[model samples]
Target chain A: MDARPTGFSRVTAPQFDPVVRLRDFTRSFGDNTIISGLDLDIAPGEFVILLGRSGSGKTTLLRTLAGLDPTPGQNVIVPASRAVVFQDARLLPWKKVWRNVALGLRQGDVRQRAEDALREVGLGHRLDAWPLTLSGGEAQRVALARALVREPSLLLLDEPFAALDALTRLRMHELVLSLWTRHRPAVMMVTHDVDEAIALADRVVLLDHGRIVLQERIEAPRGERGQVARALRSRLLGALGGQVLEGPSPAEIIALHAGGLA
Target chain B: MAISHRISASLGSARWLSPLLFLLAWEAGSRSGLIPERTLAAPSKVLSTLLDMAVSGELADNLWVSFLRIVIGLAIGVTVGAVLALVAGLSRQGEVAVDPLMQIKRTIPTLALTPLFIVWFGIGETPKIALIAFASIFPVYLNLYSGIRGVDLRLLEGARSFGLSCAEQILHVILPGALPSLLVGLRYSLSVAILVLVVAEQINASAGLGYLINNARDFMRTDIIVVCLMIYAVLGLAADALVRAIENRALVWRPSIVAQ
Candidate 1:
């Protein structure tokens, strides 16, 4: 690792109130248990990234945090207000772009608010455009705007940039960081790319076999990520039970890991 | 954009070519004695007959009666069908109570029940309107029910996450999603209504296009028969165009239809 300063000291204020909390939570589908006795807590304004191999209950955990899957008599506390962006944009094809962002908003200048939100996501020119007419990146941006318009206390992103090209994904990471900074909503993003997790998250978590296996805080500043990404990559891969190979970048390691399944 | 404009301009002219050619051949065939005027009245003769009937107010009177029957019957049939579809699509008990009966009714041809309807309601406007309504109900019910049932459950989950109440979800998400299918059903039902109206009016009617055709057949006036058939065809086309206009307006967000 480089000897540069890590930005850990920038977090000066104490974080007290938990935006999400789970204790002894367990979930199952018939005889197969997906999550069992998982305990976790997320504080307000924290940016947490979840990383795991496929079928490691990452989605189940995220859904549980979103309160979509309820386990009775287990302690699962989530804020009353929350928003989620899925892998697919999941926009309503029958609605215009602005109307889609304005969906379920009930009071006060809804059209103006929707327009403002779209503008924030760099989609002001597409208010009247149909969802089917948009490119995938544009559709995802509109989905982001829809999530932001609600101004929820908790924002859950389930691989929101998994479908984008490299350049677009980079732009989306910056966009997400800017939005997160402006709104200060507690964000929990699930991602497959280890670099992506290290780049955007304040804390990185690894999950395996229905349990959290490793947790690490990323202390590098945004501009100094290049100096520390290589070291973090091997650590994440080791936690995922894979050894880094020679002659390939960290992204290649992830691509090889993903390709091994097929 | 320029290429598309040129293509559409050519397509627009191509649409009129075949119909114009067919009319010319029809007129020529009748004049050449290859098709006798008595069998299939020449286009000119039909037009003249139409004009004469219009001048005498006979065409207008019959067309008005036919239009009234269709409007009333379609209104009643669509209302009943839509209500039943909503009831069934929204609940399991309603589906169990309504769907089987609808299926049985669907299997029974509306024409097969014409004689029974006449006996039950008597040979006045009641039986004729009832026949039209009975014929129209099935298409509307089947399409609307399937449309409501086929709404994406994923979208419903999204709506729930947005804190939409049950009624708002139905009004905004479910109904708009189903509008396209409902319009298709309306088109099918309108054609069925017209077909049943023709049959019903022929069975002892004082007025209507069917009555006019029956009268022309007794007198062997093929020109009048051809004229009445033309009116029915025009009415069907007009109703279809009306529904298309509504579909265009209501589904403006659909990218496939909204070309700039």
Candidate 2:
């Protein structure tokens, strides 16, 4: 429960117990030090978006948290119950959709659980569909179902919607928000899209080289409108070393969202 | 364009038109004394000889013996190849121990070992079976080994991230991922088994297609020889067709097949 006094990643809320806590984590590959002296924590049910450019060690941090890359001893801590949805959806092409969702699950009535999960993702009809037969967006939805079926305490999404079209990406954002609100697993989503980060995150943490350069808490509700979004856009663009008004606006995003519905 | 379309349409309708025409031409040439029957038997004569052999049970006996040799040889070779591939594919130490020897086997022609095999196994069913088995091993081993090695590392990473155990990973991910390649190896091994069976039966065989071919050669029964060669060709085609059927059924998840 002790939130250590880290440079810019100091968590203020003392009431919630974080499922993940990293203290002074440094990872290196031969001569290349990918990440160093990193400290971050994720509270239960909190959605944290990790924002950085390509070489800013965002993936390194996410991999370490996902346990794909081993952490040295006790500096990095994570719950045993965790699942990751990778960028490509990584569904085993041979397995049917429901089977892929129920993979490694050993509890009661695995198929029924998988069916429920697929239903939650609005993919109940694709329960027996092959992974290759799915569209990119459908495949990613299956990936989401697969992760959610595990009942993870920590959910890690590495650019799950990056490969999707704009309409599909908007739909995914809404679907993920509803799923998150329903399941309430602490989520860590890594992306370079500033608007996506602001749209989804409770707290946005920006990484420069390997350490956190800035952390912003969006006190407003999810999907802020008008002035709040424009101002937040300015701040994120400022951290990213670009002038304001470079990307799409909130009005355009809403239009895209409306187009998706139509 | 119209003429070309007409020709193609005729071809598309009658699948056996070319073979039937060839047979008719051969029959005419033999009747007109244009073709020496001793050199190449007429298609009609070959067909009659095939029927005669079939009725006397000679063809069935020889075919049964040849089929037995292939089945036994394939069983041994496919099992040994899969086991070796699994051992080498699953571990680093096993690869160091097994892969170099397999690579050496790959380069050297298995047929070149026929003389050595006869000397060791002494010109019986043992030597024939040994040669057949030896020929069958490399195809299955090489393809399956390459297949196992070529499994996408990212998929394995994803499996590990989901907490799949080592054994579970192999069963669910590695084996399924390598199945298409394994089937390719199986197809190659099956054909090799038949090819080696033909060679093995030729080694002082008492009963088999090779024995029948030898007797036909001595008597200069060119019709029987042609019949045996036709059987061999048909068997090869049948083996290929069987593998295609298996691929169609098993690889339905593949995008190309999924479309169908």
Candidate 3:
């Protein structure tokens, strides 16, 4: 394990192998290079957040990692089993909520597994509901259930909560954190929200012009995030080319956290 | 304002009222020797003739023959059109190979090919059914091809990320996404099938409503002719209603329909 700089302790669990490794990966579209010679690694059960401005190729990188892009790349080793939860819930409108969760599974009591997954996400009551009839947060929770039911080795989320309302987003953050802790799948989420990255990620990587410009490992304990959050916020804002403020107060964090857990 | 509201309320009910009034006027005109019953039979006379045909089983037999021809023709047309649409929609090679030829075929009105079909197939059931099938195929192909082509790329990407196979993607995503348009095609093709059936049966047929109509024209049996025409109108309405029912059930997930 790599040592952290002064005042920041390393919190990564030892003995875990890297689930995703990319070396010298390059992609371009018709002479306009998007991602060039990028290298990244995500350890098993690690939660990494990718932050970038618009057009920084964050979604492009996520898609490439999900194996959705057809273009050939160099030295990319993604897990054989992976799932993605998109910014839009992307549930098939034609399928019922339970069937959407059961999608891509071919064996072993798919309905039971889907029910269990939806129940985990607090959507057991929405098994037969239509996706269009669901609230934005409910739909996202169902999407989370769908991704998790596959029991993937790697989970990719592209701004999954960006469309949600503030209270719902807070709830979703807690839901995602709880689900991540329970499932222990390696996760890489892309987002534009700095506070979200600070709140959720084990490591936060900043991308600019398709290349990683800064990386920071968040070392604070899950429930004890207030102590180091301010210092971390300033550093992240500086990396993102923005001046730092005092940041959200400890009371706000507690209130948000309490509301989310409710 | 209240008087205006009352007037509008009555106007709304006038949809059915106007048709009833027209029937009443026709009956009165025919009974008073004004409409000239030889030229056009009264509604009551047409109804009586229809009852006579039904009692003799002649209406049932002719209607059965027409129904069988439509079913066979529509079955062939729908199957061929759907297969072609899928082939053309799924691949660039298929689009290039099949689309241009279909475009050319669409422009050559299938009704105009009746004479050519008669010469080729020789006044048999084959020619009549083939003509109906030809007329039905274009609408199904046009609508289905566009429908399949218009499937959202985002949904396809989402399916691909889940590692769905090509066949599975088509079955689950493409087919369901294209269903609304496919239903539209079905309705359009059904109407075309009936229209072509009318023409094909009129051109030459041993048994059908069209044959009954033609035979009545020779004897100046306007009442029988009116009865056959009424049957054709009823068949068209029934076909439309059937498609609407399927659409309501199949697209129940649609927000617009659900709100209704």
Candidate 4:
């Protein structure tokens, strides 16, 4: 088994077996090249938040990781089990809240697991409610619960909370953090909000022009929202220039951990 | 506001009352020599004719035959149409092969096909039932095809992400998404079934409301013809009501659509 960095010892940067390794990944729709010669590696149990403006291919990269979108033949060895939560709740309107949560569970005590997921997301009271009757925040939470209940090796979130109000978004952020703490699945979330990326991720990877521009470690505690906001704004704008920040690739950012670099 | 409410209530009640008043006026006109009795029989005379037919078991027999034809035709039409529609909806090849034929069939009025049907199948229940089924199938097919096509692509994407196979995707996602449209098609086909049955029965039916009406027309029994017309109207209303009830039960998840 590969030596895993855990707890405070994780400061040495875990020698992760790349769960999703995208090599020279190029995707195009018609003439528009969404991603070109992009290389990315996502480690298991690592919270990697992808940050970019709209059409910068953050969501596309996440979809590729989720195996939702078609890819070229070379991008094989993708994970078998994946769960995706779309920007919209995308709840089956015909199903109740609990059934929507247990959507992929198939059978056998799915009710207990579904309720537990709903409770984790603070939606236990709304288990039997009609999906159409749910608020935007509630609906998105249900979407998250559906994804989490799959117990997937990879959880891809494509702007899952972009529609919520500020307070709801904060609450969702905490719910996700607590859930991540418990399950420790490989999570790759795409968000336009830079602060959201910094607040939730262990390492924030900035994507611009379909390539990794900068990846900075957020070594601060998860609750330091203001510091995260500042760090994110700095790195996020730095990536937008599409020039190498300090002239290093993504591997260098991971390597920086051993060199006592922040 | 209260006065307006009262006026609206009165107007609502007038739906039933207006037709009743018209019937009473017709009876009075016939009694008072406003028109000749043979040409325009009173409503009383129509009711008595209907009651006599009912007692002689003629009306009941005709109703039974008409009911049987409608049921059998509907069962055959809806089953074939829905299955074909699902196939056409799901597969591009099925749609390509079947859609154009459905379009052509929809335009060819069933009444115009009666002579051809009689020649092909003889003046038996086969011709009548086939005509009804033919008339009914197109509406169901068209609505179902459109419904399946119009299902939200996002929902399918969500299911795919969960690793649902093609068959499971269709069963768990596509069918439910297309159900509302399929129900609309069901209602349309039911209406078409009864309309086609009446026309099919007009030619060489031993007993049916259509036959009764045809015989009454030949004898100039205007009273009996009116009775048959009433029965036909009632049948249409009853069939529509039954379809609506089924639709409501099936689509219990859907919120009630309050009409303005």
What are the DockQ scores of the candidates, in order?
Answer: 0.47, 0.74, 0.73, 0.65
> Comparing to the true complex, what docking class would candidate 2 get?
medium
Q: Could you arrange the candidates by lDDT from highest to lowest?
A: 3, 2, 1, 4
True contacts kept of each: 0.60, 0.83, 0.71, 0.63
Tens-digit lDDT track for model 1 on B150-184?
99887877777777899988987888888888999
For residue B46, give model 4's deviation from the true position in Å: 2.2
Overall lDDT per candidate, in order of appearance? 0.86, 0.87, 0.88, 0.81
The list of candidate 3 runs beyond 4 A from truth reads A1-16, A71-73, A246-251, A258-262, B1-13, B256-260
Report the C-alpha lDDT of model 2 over A1-262, residue by residue, as the tens digit: 2454333334666456588998888888898888888889899999999999889999989998899987545467688899999999999999999999999999999999999999999999999999988999999999999999999999999989999998799899889888998999999999999888877789999987888988998777664343466777788879878787556677457434423332
- Who is ahead in DockQ, 2 or 4? 2
For model 1, how does the per-residue alpha-carbon lDDT over A94-158 read when each residue is reduced to its tens digit?
Answer: 88999999998988999999999999999999999999889989999999999999998899999
By TM-score, the candidates rank as 3, 2, 4, 1
* DockQ leader: 2
Q: How many residue pairs clash in each candidate?
A: 0, 0, 0, 0
lDDT tens digits, residue span B207-252, model 4: 8888888888888889988888888899889978987898877776
Clashes of 4: 0
- Compared to the true structure, candidate 4 yields what TM-score? 0.88
Please report how far candidate 4 places residue A120 from its true position, in Å: 2.4
Q: What residue runs in model 1 are displaced by over 4 Å at the alpha carbon?
A: A1-15, A247-262, B1-40, B257-260
Q: Give lDDT tens digits, candidate 2, residues B1-260.
A: 99999999998899699888888999999989899988888888898999999999999999988888888888889889988998898899989999999989888887888899989989878887777788778778888888889999989989999999999999999998888998999999989988888888888889999999988898999999889898899889988999899998988889893457
